[model samples]
Target: MRISTFEYFTSGVSTMNNQQASLSNLYAEISSGKSLQTAADNPLGAAQAVALTAQAANLAQYSTNQSSALTSLQQEDSTLTSVTNVMQSIQSLVVNAGNGTLNDTDRSALATQLQGYRSTLMTLANTTDANGNYIFAGFQGGSKPFNDNASGVGATYAGGPGQRQVQISDTRTINVADPGSAIFQSVSSNESSPVSSGSAANTGSGTIGPVSVTNSNDPANSSTYTITFGTTTTGTPPTTSTVSSYSVTALDPATGTTTTVTPPTPYTAGDNITLGSQTVAISGTPASGDTFTVAPANTGNVSDTDIFTTLDSLVNALKQPADSTSSLATLQNALTTAGTKISNTYNNVLTTQTAVGGREQEVTATQTAMQTTSTQTASNLSDLVSVNLPAAISQYEMTQTSLQAAQQAFAQIQKMSLFNYLSS
Candidate 1:
């Protein structure tokens, strides 16, 4: 092979340039501590690294979401516990109020204590989260759930239905808050009694507080019975009643409207008033225009009520006077009905507690899974992009040697080149 001067010089310069470029790339790798700086370096590895990196980012975000969900649920759980305790205290007050041995002075004191519990329960129902959202307000987190009733009787539910859930994991969502209506207001009464009493507005001096179910087969009996004070008028055919009988108006508790119900037969003083499953005797010469209500204690409307309204009603029933009728037996029935309502309320709170626990378990599991996935993804990413320090150093040294040799050979060849000879 005959090599011309021009060809030899050109080839030597090309060799030196390529060696320098290799050295520069090695330096870049060392500085960055990355095996490959761009996708061009290793297309398959780069693609894999990209997938792993994205997976890691998603896992980290899921972990964060799980943490937030757990925190909110825990806060809600603590709030519910406080509410249960408050209800329990209220229950104790109700049980104590039933003691017939306690007089007006003692019963009044118990009622005052019940009022305090109602205040505490309202505070709990209005619980808030770290972000200032009301926990029991469902989707209306920014709004308060319970407020004083317009009638000034008890706290009313102002929030939406149940809570809205957040995604704790890719597969599952969990409830973070339970509203007050489901937790407190769902309690219903077991039987019927007087919810309202006749005032002087009704001409009848006769009074009735609450009625009792003395017979069987009337568990679901919700018939409404009323007593009109005026005596029955006698006609040629004795249309209304031969005796001075009080008129009875029957109502349905489910409808909350007036309907025909069987009035206690005879309707005389101290007579056992029987209407469906309900029975109560009324006495005390009732004047014209007086009326009394006989219905169930649980009106099934807790959305606007605190469970303790029945307790307050019981207290009021106890204080009512005994005017030869509607005092002793009526008061006893009220106490029993109030106790039933409180019991139902307590059961609902317990059910809510169970639901909270279930949510906690779900969130905790999701957190663990996300954390594990993040850790594994991070390891894979490290392998794909991170440089092996010792291997890089060895390769860098070899590249440096190659570059130095190229420079030395090029320098020697320059003296013999046609360009140098031509210049000389």
Candidate 2:
């Protein structure tokens, strides 16, 4: 097979060019430290790397979110701790007030201290985060959580229901706050006082008649007492009777004389009575209910009142000497009730703290799983498209040597002449 000189020269040039191109590619790989500089170099690997890089970026964002969520949760936890302390203070104050030895002056002084504590508690309930958002205000972050008249009327919560949450991971969210209102205002079954009303009368003495009271005055006080009668009703009307100051006398219908009767304690909706010679016992003080009515007798009535307000009234009542023993006892009951409320509130705070801890654990676990997955994905991507420096450098050197040899052979061939052929 005879080959033309031009064809031979062209084939030698092509071979040298191919070797140079291979060396250039190897050098580029070594210098750039990437096996695939462009999509064309390793299409599949390049595509995989792009996807992995995007995933890594997303993971980084999730990590940032997790960090922010953790900070917020920690802040919330701190605020709750402060609130718990304030509640404890209030509980202690309630306990101090419950002691009977504490005179009106002592109680009034305690109430002053209690009011200060209440103010502090209000401030805690209205606490804000670093972002200046109220922590206990639910979505209404700009609003205050607690409102008060500041005059012993007690505090009221103005914020919405608890609904704060934190995004701890890409797919998981957790509650970061519980509302102050729910924690402070939850009513317990034991705390509620049932409704009662009635009228009572003294039959044996002078001016004995049915005494009507209102719901506000029902169970007028906590002290238990009894109504005593001196006589029985022989007949009706215009009865004149003599009775001991302690005895409650009723008017006789026929004899127009006084009859003694006994009163019952904790008088229910339908209680009837007749005067007797002996005294009748009642468990609780007489007070009117919402529907209480008397045919003809005393006309004073009471209204429905809660423990907090009752204690407050008692504190002020102690300031006055005319305040009845019944009112004092009512105040005592209110103090007891307030104590229970304080205890329940503290328990609720504990419940919320427990929930927060569980959520924190969940966030930690999610973060760990995401970090591990992201790291493995990044490593796999590096293996697919990243270059091995030592191997690339060796390959580049071999290609360069091949190219030099091709160039020398081509030069020797080109130097061939007719004179050289004749001498040989």
Candidate 3:
């Protein structure tokens, strides 16, 4: 079979051109460090790399979210710890206030200390994170959670009821704040006189206190009641006087009206007084004309009955002089009731603190998972697009050698002079 010289030379040239193209491609891959620079090189691998890139980007975003959640949770936990510490100090004061020997002046001083603690508590409750978002404001991050009036005797929660959460992962979200309402406003108050007192000129060492509510009756239990003692002379010589009878008066808190009920059959000291769906057990002796009053206890959610309310009531009760037994009794009784409520409020704070701890744990776990996912995603993306450097260099050397051989053979073919052969 006769082959044309032109065809032979053209075939050699085409062969070298293909070799050169292959060698250039290997160099490009080595320099670029990407086996699949474009979809045309390896369409399926390039497509897979794109998908992996998006997944990795999402994972990175989730990691950022996890970091933010952790910061907020840490801030919240730290403030809650401060709150707990303040509450512990207040508990000690509550115990000391219950002592019967404390004078009105001594109790007032303790109340002043309590007020300082309240100020500190307000600061903690209104704490903000690194972003300056209020930690206890729930979703109202920009608003202060607790606001105290100028006198600092009372405070109100200004934030929302629900907290905000961040998505740390595709399947998980974590709470970033705890609301003040749940931590500070959810406590119930004790049944005692926020304003207990005795008749100013009474001669007996008797006192009256807030009525402790034994049976809770919502609307029916709102009246404030008062007790007045009467004395009678006895033992013929009349040297000794006894509290013979006492009348109980009910004053409607809603209306300023009063109803003095007839003395209960035997009106006696150390008897149980029931009014406003609440009860009061008064102990100790009382002189004639001595008086005591009982008022409503706190119910949850009433701004007038929050933890701040308990402290304010204590401060006011302490300021009053417990000069007589009746006055002393009122102070002691109010202190006892406040003690229980303070303990309960502390417990409520602890419950939320526990929840905050749980959220912190979730943040930690989510962060670890996100890190793992990010590593795997990066590996998968590398596998799909990254070039094997050593192997690419070997292929480049082999292609260069083949291209040189093709060029040499094509040059030898070009020298085959068909015109000289025809002359021979």
Candidate 4:
């Protein structure tokens, strides 16, 4: 077959275009520093790079989350430490006030010191983080946890019972805070005793003197009992007898409510009425015609009182007149009970702090692992998609040489076309 001029020129043009395309691709790879510029250049590599990039981004986000969680945990740990210290100080004060040697004046002085500690503790409980959020407010960061009216009555916890947690890693979460209500204001019971007087007269039963009654033991235990006075039988010598039937009530520590029960008949003064595991004594002889009601001690509402208030109550009770023996004993028992509660609360705080620390450690481990994984993935992606610059350069040069040789051959063939050969 004889080659035509048109076909030869067309072939030469196509060869030149192929060389230009190859050169352009080589130049692009060099300029972009990538052997595979698009999916068309390296399909599998491009897909792999996309997945690797996503993994890297996720790792970055996890790193940020870890850092934030660490900061929050540190702040919480510091605040709880301060709170624990304050509680310890209060515990010491309570112990000192329990001593019988302390006179009213001495007790008053201790109470004053205790009040100062309570104020300090309140401030600590209501401490805020660097971001101005209450550390112990749980999820209610904007609200103050403890509110004191400054009336020496007690303080109240205004925050919720809910807690807040943070996700430190994929498989772990930790409680970042506990609410104020959990720390204070939940009490077992509240009891109020009112002093009253009265008179009964017919034609001539008409003389009276103030009746005095006092308590000397904790009414918290079933071993302790109370005596009540029934209507009086008038005579030269007052013939007033103790009421045989009467009820005594105390607060349930768990529910913070008063529980009442009737003692066996002939409830004598100084009889022991068992309440839970503790014992309370009722030992006040009431005048005839005077009714003395004996009831279990009430632990006020937890929201109405905190650890500080309980300590204060104990201090006040200790300061009562020695003749008010029951009141003194009740106060002593209250101190013991309140101490247990405060200790438990402090332990809980410690437990939470430990848990938070553990979570933070896990976050660190996960972050380290993720970082390693991301680095390896990124390197693998580079290997897959990135071109070897030297190799690409060599291949482009070979392709250029081939295209030039093809162009010269086409030119020689065109010159030998039949018409040009015959004219020569």
Query: What is residue 91's positional error in candidate 4, in angstroms?
Result: 1.6
Q: Cα RMSD to native, each candidate?
A: 6.5, 11.7, 6.2, 9.1
lDDT of 3 by residue, 139-188 (tens): 89899888875775667788989979899888887888878887887743
lDDT of each: 0.70, 0.57, 0.75, 0.59
Q: What is the full ranking by lDDT, best candidate first?
A: 3, 1, 4, 2
Q: Report backbone clashes per prediction.
A: 10, 41, 7, 32
Model 4, 1-424: lDDT tens digits are: 9766787788788888988898999989878888777888778878888888787776677677777777777776677677778778877876776687777788778767877777777887888877898977877888997777577656766676787776644566656676766555432222222111111111111111211224434434422222333442233546555343434444445555765555434545666544344333444443443232222222343522356566566556555554444444444444554555555455555565666677667667777887787689778877876778899989888988998898788767766756776888
- Give the true-structure RMSD of model 3: 6.2
**TM-score (all chains, Cα) for each model:** 0.72, 0.67, 0.77, 0.66
Model 4, residue 418: C-alpha shift (Å): 5.9
Question: Which of the numbered candidates is closest to the native, going by highest lDDT?
Answer: 3
Off by over 4 Å in 4: 1-8, 42-48, 150-152, 158-161, 165-174, 184-262, 265-300, 311-334, 393-424
TM-score (C-alpha) between model 4 and the true structure: 0.66
